[model samples]
Target chain A: GESVGLHLPTLSVQEGDNSIINCAYSNSASDYFIWYKQESGKGPQFIIDIRSNMDKRQGQRVTVLLNKTVKHLSLQIAATQPGDSAVYFCAEKDAGNMLTFGGGTRLMVKP
Target chain B: DAGITQSPRYKITETGRQVTLMCHQTWSHSYMFWYRQDLGHGLRLIYYSAAADITDKGEVPDGYVVSRSKTENFPLTLESATRSQTSVYFCASAVKETQYFGPGTRLLVL
Candidate 1:
């Protein structure tokens, strides 16, 4: 069994500011991690991902950092905009199984 | 109209009634998953299919059943709906590592 938890359930950032959302997982066997953003009335959309062997991966204005040693994963969003206000989730993929997502953190960008 | 699409964007049902949520993808991905999101929390996988006719249970599969007869379609069924089953159900498809999700189906069980 694996448990993924978010350090912050909610985060607020001013427009143009950067936002960081953190996630902690309990599975040491997990080899893949991903970050997803879910807007209101929409499903989670892939943001970025990092493999166990890699520590970081960047996509657009988002960067995902994977700390396998600490079982920690974080998603950093640069130049936060009002459109970036959404819920972010970090998921861990075990071996070849489906992903298990964390509780999720709500990111709010104030204009 | 492309990628993934969920049917009946919103649904309402009574307890003990049976309801089915449909999910379809045009990506022809190898994996299709069903997940339920409650409140503002993260999604909990309900079931997933690795390929046609090959399915497996996920984190929360109780009272929920799923079937994937084709590579593009995965349907979730709640034999007897309960209030606790009310949530937004999302269907996703993955080819390799990354997954893509459909809009989602909002289900309410009275």
Candidate 2:
């Protein structure tokens, strides 16, 4: 079975610093990857996504890097702020359009 | 009101009881999904509907049933709820490649 997993359960970063969250996936056939952010009680929000053909995709303050060789995915936040505190999840979509989600990493932005 | 919405944001029911969680999406998207989120498990798909009257089971479909009578609504029913079924349930609607989730419904079975 294919699985998506996070390397860290919790990551604490000081304000105005760069925060990186890593994810590893087992399905090499996965072509589409997405990054989601979930607040304390809100639903997961789309952050950024990268296709297997693209090595990196950038959003406003976030960048998603995908390494198909190692089946590794990462989300990088520049100038992390308190508002960026949330649980980040990485998901991979297969050919059937089914998405496998990771356990999620809790990001705490300390002031 | 424009995006996906789930009813009974919080529910508490006992074992052997039947409970239904309603999901409504105004976008008229063809893809709708139900998922459960637990402490250790991030989010496991329960069921999904591609269109009206077109439904399929997902990763964790046991003890759950779903119906799609209309394109805008997808409801998940627990015929006989169990303690293990207690978790935060989320409803999502997808476009081409992006999925938008609703504020989940927290269910607790005692």
Candidate 3:
């Protein structure tokens, strides 16, 4: 089965620095994409989402970029904080409204 | 009081035992979903219900059964529990576009 994957399993960055998480998806028909952040001992929390028609979308401190041609998605965090340390996953919505998630990337922020 | 909740925050059971996880949401969201999270992997959907009595299988729906008797409750039952079924289970409800997740239930099967 084709699945989404992360470019790196783990990422480390200094607090207050910028961080980027990359994901590659194999499904072409996917129309919706979402980014979720999961802390230890908790469920995944929605961060940001984008549709196929849009190329970029931004939230308070998070930005989601989508490239359908290359089947790539990325989440950029500005001024990464200590609370930002968590596992990040990129999920794509298939034709049947089912979401397929990537392996996830764990982010570590060092003070 | 208006968020999703999962009962039995933590549980341990022996293999071949039947265990059921309960999920409840205060919001009258029409869509409810069940997902399991494992180490080194993202959350995978087991089952989702569009409405009451309208349920469908998801990517990894084997060894699990789900029923939506009411709009706010979606329960997942493991008919024959296995060690491999040990994972953190999360329930989510979607009213519009984004889905809100619960705290999650941790199950350990020996």
Candidate 4:
């Protein structure tokens, strides 16, 4: 069984500032990790993903860092905006192709 | 391109009532998954289908049923709905390692 959890339940950030959301997983065999942004009244949308072999992967405005040693994962948003206000979730995929998601962290962007 | 879609974006049902949520994907992907999203639980897998006529139980499959008669459609059914089953249901299809999700169906069991 895999256990994915977020360090913070809610994160408040100022507009134009950077935001960081952290996640921890219990499974050491997890090889793939993904970040999803879920808006109110919508399903979780894919943000970014990083493989266990790589420590970091960058997207347009988001970056995902995976630390296998500590079983830690983090999503960093650059120049956060109001649109970035959403619940962010981290999920780890097992060898069987099943994904286990974390509790999620609500990101609030304050203007 | 309507990659994926779920029917009855919002549904309200009563306890012991039968309800079904429909999911369709245009990508023709081989894998389809059903998940329920609840507060403090993020998303939990309910059921998944590897291909047409091939289904498997996921993390949580109690009180739920799924069938894939065609590659383009997968429907989740609750034989007898319960309040605890009230949550946003999501459908996704995988392309290699990445999975693309549908808009989701919000189910409320009264």
Which regions in candidate 4 have their CA more than 4 angstroms from the true location? none
Write down the worst ten-residue block by lDDT for model 2 chain B: B93-102
Better of 1 and 2 by TM-score: 2
By lDDT rank, best first, the candidates go 2, 4, 3, 1
**Which ten residues in a row are the worst by lDDT in model 3 chain A?**
A92-101
Model 1 docking tier (incorrect/acceptable/medium/high):
medium
Better of 1 and 2 by lDDT: 2
Model 3, range B1-110, lDDT digits (tens) per residue?
A: 75999988999999999999999999999999999988766678899999999999887899999999899999999999999999999999997557889999999999
**Cα lDDT of model 4 by residue, B18-105, tens digit:** 9999999999999999999886676889999999999999989999999999999999999999999999999999966678899999
Docking level of model 2: high
Best by TM-score: 2
Q: Candidates' lDDT values, in order?
A: 0.90, 0.94, 0.92, 0.93
Number of the top candidate by DockQ?
A: 2
Give TM-score values for chain A, per-prediction.
Answer: 0.96, 0.98, 0.97, 0.98
Q: What DockQ, between 0 and 1, does each candidate earn?
A: 0.70, 0.84, 0.67, 0.76
Candidate 4 chain B weakest lDDT stretch, 10 residues: B36-45
Residue-wise C-alpha lDDT for candidate 2, range B67-104, written one tens digit per residue: 99999999999999999999999999987667899999
Query: Interface Cα RMSD per model, in Å?
Result: 1.7, 0.8, 1.7, 1.1
